[model samples]
Target: MRTAIRLALPLVAAAAALSLTACGDEDASSDGGSGETAADEGGTDADTDAESQDSGQDGEGGSGDGAEAGTDGSAAPSVDDLMGNWFVDPADPGRSHRIVVEGPDEVSFIESLEAEGDLCNRGVYADGTLTFAPEDCLQQGAEPWPDRSATLVLNEDGTLHVTWESGLEEDYTFSESEWGTVA
Candidate 1:
């Protein structure tokens, strides 16, 4: 049962991404893999799913150690807070990527490189961090995009940072699309 849920999460995330394609400026196209990409159109403040509505509410206490901690003494960047479209920081855009996080368990990451590709992963969120399943579980054209590493952190300033098992790190700020901004 656990394995089934794990596999289904990415599939569900992919379906949710389909609804988001219309939000992009570029029409959706196949990448010959499970990954998908769309043109940049910006994000809206709209809510795409019920889960988004409650993402801001922290279920647990905040450590107040990071910038994401609530000034009011509450927690910030709750699990749901990481949902939405996150873009590469314009000031330092490299290998442009737009990551759409859907519920607490699924994410669709669209990266625009010389060879554009995207990947969907089933993961979990806790302590202001999001980690996806291993690459073996998510394949793109016979290979996983990053077969070893998948981790993300949400900074207090509403910026996002991602680290791959390959030791690559990236800083990202939220992108706005007609659909909505990255939560």
Candidate 2:
């Protein structure tokens, strides 16, 4: 049980950071690419009031490149189609998570720890999931890196779908600020 919490803490922190940062910068733009506009119809902002109260946990804040509409003028999203900043809202209310990917292969799972700073679980993507190990979460004097993994799927509406091994799942939308240069 301890191990589970250890592994899950970072994710919660990441969510906290995401929600906090996203609310403050609704007009932020991504560089070298069109930015993702904040969705106002999904009732996401309903939690903004509650989320704003706990915005101190500053995690890696970012947005994603604008999704290109498919040839048919309809954007059908796929796991392979997501290659930039994506925000994750966990099943548990009020927790927002974000991930940045260099491509389908390189990814960073970022979470903020109160005193330990940012805990980034780095790994390669395969079969639509990210697998992490001790080395993946490596940072000087960091806590024992608990094994963590999450599956990512893309929704037809261009949101990134996420499911963790622990049965925690949520739908994440593209953020307005892109992280790294897509390759």
Candidate 3:
């Protein structure tokens, strides 16, 4: 049962992502795997999800030691807070990638270099942090990560701090688009 839940989590995550989010810009194509400006995805404050409503009331209690806390000292980045184009800091468009994390599980990452499996083990976000599953799993059209996962956190400075399981740590910043400056 545990194994099944872990395997099915991505699907559940995907569904939740689809149901709770509606994003796109006039120029942004709504194609699967297409990276775009999630912040500009066309929704108002009224689009806020129910999950966010409750988090505002009690999410701050989970803050551990006040490191990387949000505006209200909440440590984890809410799914809505993560909506945007996260490009590699220092702005390298060729080497690493630009990832749009629409939800804890639904991510659209584009690597200009076409590197395969670079993010296969970026970890699966659940219950706050990204975690590695003990059981091996495979993503459609991607490589398999057997015992793979990593650490991802949103800093108070609005930067994404990621330390992959492979000992690679990097920071990602928000941008309106690939060619656009940080927004």
Backbone clashes in model 2, listed as residue pairs: 15-96, 15-97, 63-175, 63-176, 63-177, 64-175
Tens-digit per-residue lDDT, 92-125, candidate 1: 2223454655666665554432233345456555
Q: Which of 1 and 3 is ahead in lDDT?
A: 1
Each model's TM-score, in the order given? 0.45, 0.45, 0.43
lDDT of 3 by residue, 1-183 (tens): 553344345434543443233233212222244322222255223122211211111232223433354434446666555554565632444343445555566544443233222233233465445564433222222222222544556665556665556554545666544332433
**What are the RMSD figures for all models against the true structure?**
11.1, 16.6, 14.1
Model 1 Cα shift for residue 140 (angstroms): 4.4
- Name the regions of candidate 1 deviating beyond 4 angstroms: 1-76, 89-95, 113-116, 134-144, 178-183
lDDT of 3 at 148: 50
lDDT of 2 by residue, 29-60 (tens): 21222211122224344224322222221342
RMSD in angstroms, candidate 1? 11.1
TM-score of 3: 0.43
lDDT of 2 at 170: 50
lDDT of 2: 0.45
Question: Clashing residue pairs in candidate 3, if any?
Answer: 24-41
